[model samples]
Target: MTTESDVAYAHQPGGLLKGKVAVITGVGAAGTIGAVTAAIFVQEGARVLAADISGAQKETALSLGPAAAPFQVDITREEDVEAMFAHAVETFGRVDILVNVAGNPGGRRGPEVTVEEFESLTSVHLLGTLLTNKHAVRVMAPAGGGAIVNFSSAASFNIDERISMAYSAAKSGVNSLTKSVAVLHGAQGIRANAVAPGFTLSKKNHRVPPEAMKELGGKAALGRPGQPEEQAHVAAFLTSDRASFVTGVVVPVDGGWSARLA
Candidate 1:
C-alpha cells in the first residue's frame, strides 16, 4: 500500500506567488490535496494560513515550515468563517488568494439520499463556498484585488454511479456562485474561478485497490488517476499573477475525463 510519506512533491519553485499571502481551506491531512496545495503555495513564495476543521491542521501547517500557519475553522459556520479571515490578516497582514478545497464525499444515490443528506452536502459545498468568498471579497476588495479558487468536481457535469445526486447539485451550485462572484467583484480586481477535478488519488482514495483504481482511471483519456500535486499546480498558477487575465471560468483538471464522450 502507498503511504502518505511515499508521496513526492518534486515541483521546483519559481516564485510564481512571491510575497503573496493565501488562505487555503481543507488543509487537515498530510498528503491530501489541501495540504499539498499549502506546501506548493509556500514553495512558490507565498505565506499560507492552512485552515481546516480538524485539529491535525496545526501539525500539517507546521510541516510546511515557517511560511505556513494553521487555523481551525468550520466553513459551515459564519462566525468561524469570519474569524478565519481575521486570523489570516493578523498572521499574514493581507490576503491575496483564497482556495476552498474542503468538501465531503457523497455516497448516496438519488433515491437513497435524504433531506438531511442533501442539506448537508449543500451546506458544506455551496453554502461554505459562499461564506468563504464573501469574507475573502471583504478583504480582497479593499486591498485592491485578490484571487479565489473554489473546488468543483467532474461529477458536476458527468454522471457517475459512484457519485450522489446531492453532491452533483451542490457542485453545480458552486460553479454558479463562482461566476457570480467574478461578475460582481471583477471590477474590484477580485478574480473568482473554479477547478473541477476528476478521479484524483487523494488521501481518501489511497485505500482503493490498484485494480479498481486502474479501471476507474482508465475511463479518462489520460488512462490514469490524477495526483493532488497535479491539481495543486494548476491552483497555484490560477492564483498567481501569471493568470492575471483569467477569471470567472471553471477549469477542469480532470486529465480529459470530462472530455471523453464514451
Candidate 2:
C-alpha cells in the first residue's frame, strides 16, 4: 500500500527520492526552510510527514495534496517526539529521512541573559536536535540506515550584531551533534549532516523592513538575502542519494557571508 509519504514517486516525474519516507518538522511556515524542503522532497517522489507545533502544517500539507501528511508536534517533549516517529512508521512502514527543522533564534546578548532565557532557545535548538536524532537513529539502524538533516545557522560561529549568544552556542552544539551521529552510526549506514543558512527571508516574517533585509544582505558576499528554496535545495541534495558519499559535514548556504570579515 503506497502512502502519502512515498506516493509522490508514482505521479511525480522526479525519482530523486523515489520510494523514500521522510519525517519533516517545522513546516508550519509556508516559506520556511522546512516547508520548502517538504515540497521539494515530495516533488522528487518522497512521501512526507510534515510536522510542526502549529496548525499551519495542516494547511501546507493540504496545499501540497497527497504527497504530504500533517502531524502536529512539539519537539521539546519526549512524548511528542516519540509519537511523531511512531506515526511516521505507522503510515509509511519505514523511515529513510528525518529533517529536524524546528528551532528558535531568540535569546539574550552579552552578560544580561538569564539562564531561563538561554534554556528556552537551547531546548528548541539543541535539545530538539538531540531528541529527534536519538529517535531517528534508533529507527534507521534497524531499517538498514538512513539520513538526518538538522538545521544549523551561520550565527553558530560567525559573530554578528543580530545573533544572540545563546542561539549561536546552541546551533554550534547542533553541528557537533551532527558529527557525533555521523561517526557513531556510520557503520549502520546512517549519514548525518547539517545545513547552516544565513539571512534567509520568509513571508511569515514580513515585520522586518525591506531596508533591514537589504542591510543584512549587504553583509554577504552574494549581496542578497537567501530564499528559502535555496536552502531547501541544499537539504534535498543531502537527504537524496546524490550525496551518498557525503556525511558528517555542516554545509554553509550563507552566500559567502560566512567568509566576510566584520
Candidate 3:
C-alpha cells in the first residue's frame, strides 16, 4: 500500500543537485566512467537522462530509480541528438546541465587513415558537443542559465605514440569549442567548461597485464591510475554552484599525468 507520505518522501529536495536536471550521455555499461558519473549525479538528487548508443542505458536508469530517464542516441546523427534533448525536456521539464561523455577510443592507428577517421572522431566528440549545447542554450538561455561539461582527453596535451592522430585532434577541437561557447554565452547566465582526463582505468582498459598497468601508472605523477569516480567528483563540482565563477576553462582531471609527462 503506497501512501502520499511515501511519495512525498521520495520527491524531497536534497541539496547538491536538488531539482536539477542533468542529461548525461555515455552511460552504456556498468563500471564505466559514464555510469559512475550518473550515479554521482543521482546521489546528489539530480534527475538524469542516461543517454547511450547501446541498450544498456535502460538498466543504468533502473538502478537510479524513477528520477532517471534513459535514451538511446547516436550522437553522430542530428535527429537522434534532437530527440535526446526533447525527451529530457519532456521527462524532466528542463535541462539544467549537460554532460557530453560519448567517446570512442579512435582505434590504435590506421595504415592510411582517411576522412572517415576524422569524421568519426569529430562527429562524436566535437559535433555532438556542439549540438547538445546548441539545444541546451535554446532551452536554458530563456530560462536564464545552465551548465555544460564536455569531455576532452589528456591526449590533448601529450604526443602519445599510442593515440591516433584523429582522436587527439578532435579533442583539441572540443577544448576550443568549450572556451568559445563560454565566452559567447557567459553573459547569458550559461556556463561552459571542459574536462581532460588522463589514462583513467576502466573495465575496458583495466584488463591489461600487470606490467602494462605498472607502465601506465608510471605515466602519471600520482604513480597510479585514476578512478572514474575521481573524475565524476570533479565534474560534479564543475557543474555545481561551487564553481559558479568558473567558465571558459579547461580543467584537467588527470592524475597529474600531463605534468609528469612535461
Candidate 4:
C-alpha cells in the first residue's frame, strides 16, 4: 500500500493523505487535473487507483509507480461502477476516498437537444455520482469512515455562453447530489463534498479561441485560466484530514470568477 514516493509530497512530514486509498475517475494523459491529483495523492502516501474510460489509462498508471493502479471504467454504467469499487478493494484492501470526475459535455443546442443528450450528461454526472458514492459508502460505513469529492462545474452557478444547457443542468444536479449524500451519511463517518471548477483547459474541451480565452480569464478577478494543479490541491485538501469537519460544501476552485460576476 505504501510506496517510497508517497512519503515525499506530504504537506507535513507525515502529510494529509498518507495511508489513504483513493479511487479517481477520469484520469487521462499526463498534464490533466486527474493525473496531477493522482500523482500528488500517491506522493503524499495514498495508494491511488486512477480510472478512465480511455485506453490510455494503462500508460498513465505505469508512470505513477507500484502504489498506483489504473482501471478502465465507464462511469455511465452501474456494473462498471460496481466493478471499479470492487477492483479498488481487491487491490488495496479498502477504499478511503472516491473522486468523481467522469463527465461529458452535453453538446447539443438548446432547441435541438434530444432526450439522449440530457440522458448522456445525467448518466455520467448524476447517476455516476450516485452509483460511486452508494458502493463507496457501503464499504466505508462499516469500516469506520471515508471521504468523497464529486466534480461540479462553476457553470451551474454562473451562466456560461460557451457550454450547453444540458451540461449546466447536469452539473447543477451533481451539486445537489453532493449535499444529499453528505446530509444523509455524515453521522455514519462518511463525508461528501464537491469541487466546482471554472473553465480549466482540458484536451477535449479547450475549444475557445485564444482571444476568447484571454477575455474569459480577464473576467475572473485572478485574470487567468486555472491550472490543473490548482484544482488538484483543492481535491487533495477536501479528502485530507484538515477537512475533517467539512461536508456538503461546494468549494469553487474558480479563481474567484463566481465572485467577480457578483
Best by TM-score: 1
Residue 80 error for model 4, in Å?
A: 1.1
Candidate 1: residue 240 Cα off by (Å) = 0.4
* Candidate 2 TM-score versus the reference: 0.92
CA error at residue 49 for candidate 3, angstroms: 0.7
- Model 1, 134-231: lDDT tens digits are 99999989888899999999888878877899999999999999999999999898999999999999998888898889888887788899999999
TM-score sort, best first? 1, 2, 4, 3
How far in Å is the alpha carbon of 5 misplaced in model 2? 22
How far off is residue 64 in model 3, in Å? 1.0
lDDT of 3 by residue, 1-262 (tens): 1135533543444556666899998888887788889999999879999999988999988998998989999887888888998899999899889888888878756455577877888888889888887877877788778888998998887667667888988899999989988999888888999889887876687887889788877788888888899888878778876567789988887778888635
Q: Write the per-residue lDDT of candidate 2 for residues 62-175, one digit (tens) a residue.
A: 888887899999899889999999999998888999999887766468777789879899899888999999999989999888999999999886778667888888999999
TM-score for each candidate, following the candidate numbering: 0.94, 0.92, 0.91, 0.91
Evaluated at residue 86, the lDDT of candidate 1 is 96
The clash numbers for all candidates, in the given order, read: 0, 3, 0, 0
Top lDDT model = 1
For 93-161, candidate 4 gives per-residue lDDT tens digits of 999999887777767666788888888888888898888889888878888778899989888886776
Question: Whole-model lDDT, candidate 1?
Answer: 0.90
RMSD of each: 7.1, 4.3, 6.0, 4.0
